[model samples]
Target: MNAIEIINLTKYYGKNRGIIDVSLQVKEKSIFGFIGPNGSGKSTTIRTILNLIHPSSGEAYIFGKNCEKEYNEILKDVGYLPSEVFYYSNMKVIDLLKYSASFYKKNCDDRINYLSKIMNLDLTKKIEDLSFGNKKKVGIVQALLHSPKLLILDEPTSGLDPLIQQNFFNLLKEENKKGMTIFFSSHVLSEVQKICDEVAIIKEGRIIKIEKINNINNNNYKRIKIEVNYKIDDTFFNNIEVTNLIKEKNIYTFMYKGEINSLITKLSKIDIINIWIDEPSLEEIFMHYYDEKM
Candidate 1:
């Protein structure tokens, strides 16, 4: 069974729009990335999947059970961390975590302590006394203490330091390896590139693309730089499937997508002093998506 499935899901608030026909499928034990600009319905889709808010049309299912009808039972195996977290200001950090753990049947004290140590959290402090980063750590611990089957994170790295973010990602990889499926929602394309097996890109409250990370990169344009021993005519690279080609004395650089043999054959005619070829970053590919829509 899929970890999460949405069949033409749509939601509306009075006359306001939420999402439209947002169909998606997250396979079990897979780390799926959900990406979009702010207010683009990423959160709305997640909320509907969790059954936090009702959808006006279509339906969502988790582990083959209808989300709207089986949310109570589903919650037992799910952990969620929102873009923003809120808690009783007066409560101590440890107290708040204990209260949250109470909702689950397992005794999570040892798990709580273990997570706190790894996250470098001070559970003795009052909730109001912690910084935003610390509070986010608390949320991270809260979500993982029960070793849930599924983890839903929304902009989960906000306010986290670089070291903490690295540690957090490593921890997530460990959990995912242990059979916990993950749904990561964020605008940070770099992180998604590094972690997700497949990515779903949403724009203007609609899903525009869903594909494997490898598939996206395999067809990605390559950036090439060459320094010939002698200068070449401007039209020498004509019909070579290049973009952004620039020439400076003996150097020529551009983005290439055509056959490598064609490029090598052309370059063999010249005395090349230096050459460089590299894969474009995920950020470049992400920008290509938005640019094409324009």
Candidate 2:
């Protein structure tokens, strides 16, 4: 069964479009990545799914229940962490957690204790006194303490240190192993690449591509920098699909597409001194998509 399903969902604000005809299904027990640039409607879609805002058109469903008609029941099994967290400044961490826990009838102390130890969160400090990163830790604790079946997190790593971020990811992996479904939204491609089983890329309020993480063409291209014994004319590399070419004396740095064997075969005839190949990063792949949209 799908953990969440959105069908032809659309939203608008006055004359501006928020999202249009966006449809997606998140499978059970999978980490799904909702990726887009800022203001691309990722948050809008999430808010609509949570029933925090009414959709202008279309429908959203949680576990086969209509989002609007069964919001209370649906929310009981879900935990959400918004991109921006706002807490009462004067409240202590323990107090805030206790207050949040009051909404559910079951005791949550065990879950809270487990998460606090794993995240290394200090519950003694007041919300106002905690650092930004620590406050994020508190948010993480609250979101996971209930042990909700469906977890929705938006930019969850905003203020976390590198170490804590790694720990949090480890925790997510553990949770997924027990059959939890996670839908996380972020523009950080590297983090998404690390944890998500599947991803959907949105551009200009529309989802342009959806693919399994393992299916991505990570081997798109390579960059080669060669130091040649003889100076070559610029036209020698013109028809070679070369990009970002930099030449200094007899050395040339350029990007190449396709197999290395063909390029190597051609370069073998040249008097070459040394060469190095650079692989493209996830950021470079994201930028390629963004540029296509523009």
Best model number under TM-score: 1
TM-score of candidate 1 on Cα atoms, chains taken together = 0.89
After superposition, candidate 2 runs with Cα above 4 Å error: 217-279
Kindly give the stretch of ten consecutive residues in candidate 1 with the minimal lDDT sum.
Answer: 283-292
Any idea what lDDT model 2 has?
0.87
TM-score, each model?
Answer: 0.89, 0.87
- Per-candidate local distance difference test: 0.89, 0.87
lDDT of candidate 2 over 1-294, digit per residue (tens): 899999999999887989999999999899999998899999999999999988899999988889988999998889999898889989999999999899988899888888988899998889999988888889899988888999999899999999999999999999999988999999998999899998988878899878787755455567688998777866778647776677988789876777678888878877889988886555556666676567
Candidate 1's residue-wise lDDT over 169-239, tens digit each? 99999999999999999998889988999999988888988989898777757888998877676777885
**RMSD, candidate 2, Å:** 2.7
Against the correct fold, how does model 2 do in TM-score? 0.87
RMSD of each: 2.6, 2.7
The runs of at least 3 residues in candidate 1 whose Cα sits more than 4 Å from the true structure, single-residue gaps closed, are: 226-254, 266-274
